[model samples]
Structure formats: C-alpha cells, structure tokens
Target chain A: MTTVPRRDRPGFYYPKPPATWWLRRPNYVLFMLRELSSVFIAIFLVLLLVQIHQLSQGPAAYAAFVERLRSPGWIAFHVVALAFALYHSITWFNLTAVVQVVRLGERQVPPRLVAAANFLLWGVVSLVILFFFLLGG
Target chain B: MSTRKTSEPFWWGLFSVGGVVAAFLVPVHLFLHGLAVPLGWIPVSPARIQALVGHPLIKLYLFVLIALPLYHWAHRFRFILEDVGLHALRAPIAVLSYGSAVVGTVLTLWVLLR
Candidate 1:
C-alpha cells in the first residue's frame, strides 16, 4: 500500500518533465490555466475579506473601501478575475459529469444529463445571488 | 524521505468541496461585487449591504464563500509548485499553502462573528 515512485529504482526510467511541459499542448495549457484560476479566486476572496473588515469598521470605512473598489485599477483586476472565475465554473461543471455518477433505480444517468443538471442548478444559484444583489431589498 | 502519516485525504476532501463552492458560487459574486456593484451599474445602498452582511445567514454564506475556496487554492497551488520544479520542497510547500488557508479561515470567522 506504500509504493514509492522515487527515481533511481532499478530498471526504471523516471522522466522529469521540464517546467514548460504544460505549455506544449493546448489541453495542457488549459489545464494549467484551470489550476491557476483558483489563485485568482482566492485573491478575490481576500479582497472580500478586506471589504467585510471595512464594513465592520463602520459606514465611512466601508464607503472608502467601495470607492477604492470603483477605481479603474480595481475594476480592471475584477474584469480579469471574472474571466478566470467563469473559466473555473465551466471547467468544474464539465468535469462533474465524469466525477458524479447519478443513479435512478436500476439505470445510471448519462454523463451529459448529469452535467446538464449541474448547469441547471448553477443557473438557478446564479439567479438567486443576482436577486439578492439587485432586488432582495 | 520522512515517513509521516499522510493527511492527504483530509485536504483532498476540502479541495473537492471547495472546488464545488468555487464553481457554483464564485462567478456571480465576482461579477456583482467585483464588477457590477463597484462600477455603479447595479445601484446598491450602502446601508442595505451593511445590514445584509450583519445577518447571520449572510455571514454564514460569506464564511463559506470566502474560506472554502482558499483550501482549494492551497491544494492546487501545492501541486503547481511541485509542477514548477519544487518537488523536493513539497513538504514545506504543503505546510505553507495549507497553513495560509487555515489562517484565512480563522480570519474569516473572526471578521464574520466579531
């Protein structure tokens, strides 16, 4: 159960891929981009935490934070972050079909249907958030 | 080469759950908070958002939204570091990445509840 795949094993040729291997193939490029997406998302969450902390500091502080957020630099950062976030969502849902196998009695649901269900749920969740943001007053 | 009990599964579970959260929830938030509201496209009164953030349910949502994806980032960033030729330093990388996530989680709780 504890098999180690270390180099220098007898009769084994361990190939260490170069750092740029991910750049070689289009899928590899996208795969690397997908992994990189979380970093951006994490960065956004940290910004959210800063915004929340500003809110805790009271109205003026929160307003200051909002003003800073409205600056062109922050807006541009967000435009990029939104792009990465969308890529994350699309790739994540696409992979869910492969990872989640839904079963209905004796029949297993098709992978496309599973992914489609996830997309439907994704849309509904998005709409709910939009509602809370725009019209939940 | 140190024989440590692997905590891989625990981290992996968090990664998967965090991935789900990021995929399902991150875009709308990013779009609204990062772009729309900030750009003044969707008018939001400061007091309304203030009240919303103070609500217990919204606090819970914020905690989930901000904290879990951090773990996902930690896990993936660990692999990314290894991929980028830091394989020898993976143990330290794992500690650093996941430790930051833990710190982020604690800070999230403090900000939300305090």
Candidate 2:
C-alpha cells in the first residue's frame, strides 16, 4: 500500500506565517521616515520664497513677514520642520562617505573619514557665519 | 576581467566642488542678513539689498551658488532614494528633482531681475 504525503502537513520547511508586517520586514519603517522628511525641504523652500517676496515688496511687507514667522503657529511649524531637517542631514551625511570614492594608489579612504570631513566642514561654515554675524560685517 | 564602472568619481567631484562653494557663500549670506544689517554695522537699509542684488558680480555669484547647489542636492537626493531600495522610482525622482531645480533657477532669475 502506497501512502500519500499529507498536503496539510506543516514541518520545518514552512511552520507558520509571520505574525505581522513589522515582524516580516523591519526596514520599511526607516524608509518611510526618510521619504517623509523630504516634505520638510519643500516646506522650507516655500517659506524662504515667501520671505523673499515680502522683502521685494517693501519694508512694511517684510516686517509683516517677519512678524508672521515669529508667531506661535509658525514657530511650531519651524520646530517640527527643523527636527525633520536634522534627521535628513544626519542620514545624508552618513551616506556621503559611501557615495564618494577616494583612492590613494591601491588604498581607499575610509567612509567614516568622509563623513567626519563633511561634519567638520559644516562646523567650520557655521563658525564663519557666526563670526561674520557677530562682527557686524 | 569585466570592468565595473563606478559612480564614485562623479559623486566625489560633485561633493568636493559643492563643499568649497558652500564654505564661501554661507558666511557671506549670514553676514548680509545677521551682522551687517541687524547689528547696524553695515547699515540695514532696503536700498542696500537692492544695490547688492543689482550688481553684475553679485548677481553672477548668486546665480552660480543657487544653481550648482540645487543640482548637487537633487542628484544626492535621487541617489539616496535609490540606495534605500526604491530603484523603481528613480526615474520619477530624477525628473522631479532636476525639473524643480530648473524651475527654481528660472524663478530666482525673474525675481532678481525684477
């Protein structure tokens, strides 16, 4: 007598399905965060353009624009957007080393070095800007 | 050996050039807005802004700074998305980024001219 293999049998090959989407795949969460941060960049540009328009109009319009930016609602918007921008900056900087290729003969520069350089450059730029601002130049 | 072409050179070139330009322009921008005008160091008149923007040299500088940074940013963002496993969306992302850069440059030029 030939025995038929059980179609409903569950063994090591396939025991049970994943409990949830998160359990099945975890990277999607980070992907969503990164993509969502792009919205802040768009928002920032719009804010800047509006400010430029106000400046072009005249002093009164510019003053109104500045006042609007200082409002609670705008402040809150900027705070949230700033957080997103920080996240974007961190992630983007981390990727810089990976994307850039530097080779000295057969030896390649490390990615960490690239990332470090980028951060350092940012620091220097910030300092210069601060200096110029403080010096009233 | 089948040689694989690497994108590293292009990326490095872009970042290097951008880094240098940013190092210079950012300070000038900050000074103009923060110290020069706000602190009453260099005078905070609207006429100053108009004059600065009207200068041919300053206008050219602004154009380069705006256009190059936009291009660099768009390229970087496109690659970042691709690296994160969104290969299918690369075409659309590239189009959107480059298109926005071009539009932005045109708009900025119009504003400056007016």
Candidate 3:
C-alpha cells in the first residue's frame, strides 16, 4: 500500500510560530518566565555546592567566598534569583491544584482550596526556616 | 518535530519529582542562606552555617535539593529550546541536558560525602 505523505500534497501549509511567540500574550510570557526560573535555581544550587566544597577546604577559603558575596553585584544577582525562585515556587504550587484532584464522597475538592493549602504549607515551612535563624541554633 | 518516545515517561517522572522537591524546598533555602545571612538580615556567622551543613540531615537535604532540581531544569529547558525551534537538534539537546543533570547529581553526592 503506497500512500502519499500529507506534507507532500498541495495546500498543506502548517504555520510555525516565531521564536518570540511568548511575547504574544501576557500568560505566555509568564509561562516562559516560570520555565526559565529553573535555570537560576539550578545555578544557585551549583553555587551552594561550591560553597560547601569551600567549607571542606578550610575556614579561610569559606570566609573569602562569603566575603566576596558582600559585593553589590552578587547581592543584585541574589535578589533577582530570589524573585525567580519565588515565582517558580508559586507557579509550581498552583499547578499542583490542577494535577491532583481529590474526591470526597461525591464531591470533588475545589482547586482554589488546594492552592490555598499549598500556600499555607509554604508559609509554615518558611516560618520554620525563619525560626531556626531566630533561635540561632 | 520528532515523535515522542517510550522513555519519555521515565525522564518525565524524574522531572515531576524534581519539580515538587524544588517547589517546596528551594525558596526557603534561598530566603535563609542566599538572602538573609548574606544581607545581614540574619546574624548567623559562616562557622554556624558550616556547622549546619556538616549535620547529616542537612547534608541529605542539600543532596536532594541540589540534585533533583538539575533534572527539572534540564527537562524544562530542553522543551523550551525545542519549542522555540531547535527541533533538529532534539536528540543532542536531550543528551546534553540530561547529561549535565547526571553530572550535577554526581558532584552533589561527592561534595556531600566529602
């Protein structure tokens, strides 16, 4: 059975979106930014691992690295990375509401409730981290 | 575009788990070490931070935090590049992306163990 390929036939124009298609809509841009956030977060992890490696080297090396971080450029980078990481977390939690649907008896749990729960958990976890810093132990 | 492969689910499974881990843990880590201590918002010293990292539980936490997110980033970045029209290099992109994550995971474990 010999069949002609669809693309080989006439009038089969499949439009390809431009590279900047994300700029076409606000939501699309947001989605792209959310995806891009992972890169910054990964970079942060690598730097943290490097810091850990420095810690293993000696106190002097670790202190030097920490001292270097006091520069304005590093601070600005951290600020931007913080924004991206927070955005990534929020978007990921909201996505959980869509991905996991729970049913109680005959009624399904509302997505808003799910999202709220996620935010609440996030808040609690953040507070616990803050508590550690506050307790200084 | 090339068709999806059977192995996609396996890689995607890692990506999903990584996303969940990153979403829950990453922000808090950034807020504490990345922002607070560095900015002088928290009065913790480097020795204190080092001792915390020396703890077994924190080491394990760091391992999971650093390793999984690499894969998550790899998967997302691969798709983004492809969607933006790097379809011809899909196979190579997948290899490069996932390879970096694997290398990252190894580096994380080695550092934590040391």
Candidate 4:
C-alpha cells in the first residue's frame, strides 16, 4: 500500500507584514491618518452628546459645561479634533466619486466632476449652516 | 479556514451609509460648534442651543448625526487595529467595536427621548 502524505506537514514560510508597514509609503501614512480621523470625530460626538446631557440638567449646568470648554487645553483639543473631522469628511467625499457610478447615455460621468459636485454640495450645506448659526444668531 | 459566512457586508453597508452622512454634515457641525462658537465668531447662548436640541426634528437629526458615524468609526478602527497585526483577536475585536457602537446608538436614542 502507498503511504499517504500527512496534511500537517511543513509548508513554505510566509512572512508577516511588519508593524511599521504604514511607514514604508506616504500613501500608507495618509491611509492610517484617514482611518484615525474617524476616532477623533467620534470623540467630538461624545463630547457634544455630553454637552446635550448637561443641557437637559438645566441652564446653569449647561452654561458651566460650555465655560469649562473655554480652557486653552480643551480649545486646543477641539481644534485638533476639528482638523481631523474635516480631513475625514474631505476624504470620504472624494471617495464617493469612486463608489458611485453615473452614466449619461453611453458615456460615463467623469470622476473629477463627480468629486466637484460633492464638494459643491458640501459648500452649500455648510453655508446654510453658517447662515443659520452665525448670521441669523 | 472555516466556511462560516460573515456579517461583514452588513456592517460595511452601515459604514458606507454612515460615511456619506458624516462627510456631508460633520465638518459643518464641527466648524460651528467647536471653532466658531467658542471663539465668539457667532454669538449664541447655551440656552438657544439647548432649545434647538429640544426640537423633535433636531433630535432625529442628532440621532442620525451621532449614531451612524459611531458604527463607521467602529468598523474603520476595527480594520485599522487588524492591519496593525491583531489578527488573532478578530472576532473579539469585532464584537467589542460593534457592541460599543450599538451601546452608543441606544444612548443617543435614550437621550433624545428624554
């Protein structure tokens, strides 16, 4: 009888990607930062939700909470979070061009135009918000 | 590898929708609340904002704004951690990440209802 080969026998060695793989390329660094932007945005949302909770507590509590955020350190943290949130938003908008396919007749819509349209919509919405909060107030 | 089907597509679907929502709305919110308000570029009181939040429409808006990005964050962070070489802990990590998002969503709904 022929001897059967064991299934658990040694195979070719497969090298694992290094922990510093992101450091190898600029695009990798950008990708990591983009991924990290979500975390920063999440932190901001948590802070906002906490503020709303304070609001429910009463005006004094809400005013006190907002006052606490005026500290230089907290302001700086918000600044950084804002930057990350903006970065995340921009990258995501750009990606919509890739994920969505729009064809006009037999011709495909250009990705650049798609991205521009996204940016335009973003601008319009932001402006509406600004009008409501900044000027209207 | 086991032939078990994954719920990854479902989670990814949420992430995709959340990404669109976050991209469209989050930056403006951040700019208004974080930078403009604190620096006094816009003169609005806490009471005004509280009243705004009290509206039913605003509550629904906040639910969408706060809840979806959470799952988006969860999914992205899960992959990032995995990429950094925590391959062995995939299942536990997925549970923890998505579970946190679900908890956040519930908290948002509770706060809105209150």
lDDT of 4 by residue, B45-106 (tens): 77678778888988998999999999999999999988887765778999999999999999
Could you give candidate 2's per-residue lDDT for residues A31-68 as a string of tens digits? Answer: 55555555544455445555566777887887676666
lDDT of each: 0.90, 0.57, 0.84, 0.84
Superposition error at A118 for model 4 (Å)? 0.4
Classify candidate 4 by CAPRI docking class.
medium
Q: In order of the candidates, what TM-score does chain B achieve? A: 0.95, 0.69, 0.90, 0.93
The candidate, 1 or 3, that scores higher on DockQ is 1
Query: Per-residue alpha-carbon lDDT of model 3 for B2-111, expressed as tens digits?
Result: 46466888889899989988888888877766777666787766677778888999888888889998999999999999778666578899999999999999999999
lDDT of 1 by residue, A1-137 (tens): 11225553555444567778898899999999999999999999999999989987888998889899998999999999989999998889889888888899999999898889889999999999899678854
Candidate 4, residue A4: Cα displacement in angstroms equals 26
Best by the lDDT measure? 1
Off by over 4 Å in 2: A1-26, A134-137, B1-100
- lDDT comparing candidate 1 with the true structure: 0.90
* Per-model TM-score versus the true fold: 0.92, 0.59, 0.89, 0.91
DockQ of each: 0.76, 0.12, 0.65, 0.68
In order, the first chain's TM-score in every candidate is 0.87, 0.73, 0.84, 0.84
Clashing residue pairs, backbone N/CA/C < 3 A, model 1: none
Interface Cα RMSD of candidate 2: 6.9
Question: Which docking category, incorrect, acceptable, medium or high, applies to candidate 1?
Answer: medium
Best by DockQ: 1
Best-to-worst lDDT order: 1, 3, 4, 2
Q: Rank the candidates by TM-score, best first.
A: 1, 4, 3, 2
